[model samples]
Target: MEYTSRHTDGKRINTRSARRPCFLPGRIEGYGTKLQRDIDGKKTWNDFFFHVVAPPAMLDHGVWPDSPTGYRAANEEYCGHMMRLTRALFEHLSLGLGLEKGAMAEAFGGDELVFLQKINFYPPCPQPELTLGVAPHTDMSTLTVLVPNEVQGLQVFRDGHWYDVKHVPDALIVHIGDQIEASMNELEPN
Candidate 1:
């Protein structure tokens, strides 16, 4: 997409060199070059994962027109598409569960739902066997729509094995996150 391509378009800010502060949900972090995961006080993972988070308001307010890479227009366009898709998916899911069309959307706060855009960039690793690009973990969001590039590295742990996710052109993968799993558990009978 245009948003992803803008990273190399020379007009976008170089997040690695800019050293800007990123405010995550629970913690604040400084921009860094390498990707490291502290597993019980030991640093692991030899990979490069760069990400940019855009708040919901940014979707409404366009990015600066002449500022470097023109990421604002691209990001804004992508976010709008995602928002509509997510809403439609929620509606279909609610119907599948034998509920009204807007039931799931209503539970998620309707028009006030907060949507944040996160773009992750993972570069090549020298010793691929020695480290992981992203540590194995469940997603924390209510839902996640992933659009991976041609180089496929995504995997899912299932049936006691890690299975590679085959890449499909022009396809989007939707993952049910922890929130949905928790809600399903609560709905289960004793």
Candidate 2:
């Protein structure tokens, strides 16, 4: 849980708390699938058919992946771990901004913080160039952590150019969203 010097300038900070365990059971109450993306008649959305899930849909017995027998347990476990990592990352970022460890979490809604995951499954495609996985836009959440496959797809816009971020194995990409930007603006000195 230590924030590396690369993310911080020579400052090593551990954002995890002893009270927070590795796996949380009841914390994720429920899981649900928000959509089964198949808008265009091509069967999938440019090789990427997306599905979103949240707690409410799960508890209400919403559409879930029925084919994968052991998906519920696995997805639950993955979400739990990601939540923990996100909390730690938020705290570490808070420390980076010279605020209390819980400051960012508090700003992000504390205990009521919602974590909705949008999973984009990119199947094998013959014409890869003619598809759009996701349109060019900014995320609206406080933060977003992307766990992508070996495929190099993510790009960052800079200086009138789009630069593809090289894929590194076992790496999680984190992006600060608009809410974080709004929070930073709020913190800006007069």
Q: Each candidate's root-mean-square deviation in Å?
A: 6.6, 15.0
Error of 1 at 159 (Å): 1.7
Residue-by-residue lDDT tens digits, candidate 2, 98-175: 888888888777876777765554434445455456556799988899987787778999999999998888989999
Pairs of colliding residues, candidate 2:
31-58
In model 1, what are the clashing residue pairs, if there are any? 11-68, 11-69, 12-69
Q: Pick the candidate with the highest TM-score.
A: 1
Worst 10 residues of 1 by lDDT: 58-67
Q: Against the true structure, candidate 2 has what lDDT? A: 0.61
> How many collisions per candidate?
3, 1
Q: Please tell me which predicted candidate would have the highest lDDT against the true structure.
A: 2
Candidate 1 RMSD computed on C-alpha atoms after optimal superposition onto the true structure: 6.6
Would you list the C-alpha lDDT of every candidate in the order shown? 0.60, 0.61
